[model samples]
Target: MSTPELHWFKSSFSSSSEPGDCVEVARTPAMIHVRDSKTPGTSHVTVASATWESFLAYVTE
Candidate 1:
């Protein structure tokens, strides 16, 4: 099946001074997509929504 188009956005925590050094994220109903902002055309990593949420909670704590 074809992958659906994703709407990506740079993380707010990313350093604005270094535009090329930012991380981008896209969300779906059950998945979260991540990629380097500088290399948007390259491959991205996908994880379950729950896993992404757990990761965020861990890192933020």
Candidate 2:
């Protein structure tokens, strides 16, 4: 599949004032995109909006 037009933002959970390993997050109308900041263009994962929310809720619980 073609890559979606996603504008990724670094997660608020990240606390690195320096450049190193990090995770990025982006959201579309229907889904969320997640990727590594160091390897922005090549490594990533995606999930449906509902699934992403569920995952976050679980993590924060």
Clashing pairs in 2: none
Top-scoring candidate (lDDT): 1
Among residues 3 or more apart in sequence or in different chains, the pairs in candidate 1 whose N, CA or C atoms overlap within 3 Å are none
Candidate 2, residues 3-59, lDDT tens digits: the string is 667888889767687667678999998888898888886967879999999988998
lDDT of 1 at 60: 83
Model 2 weakest lDDT span, ten residues long: 13-22
TM-scores for all candidates: the values are: 0.88, 0.79
Error of 2 at 34 (Å): 0.3
Stretches of candidate 2 off by over 4 Å are 1-4
**lDDT of candidate 1 over 4-56, digit per residue (tens):** 89999997668889768998999999999999998899999999999999989
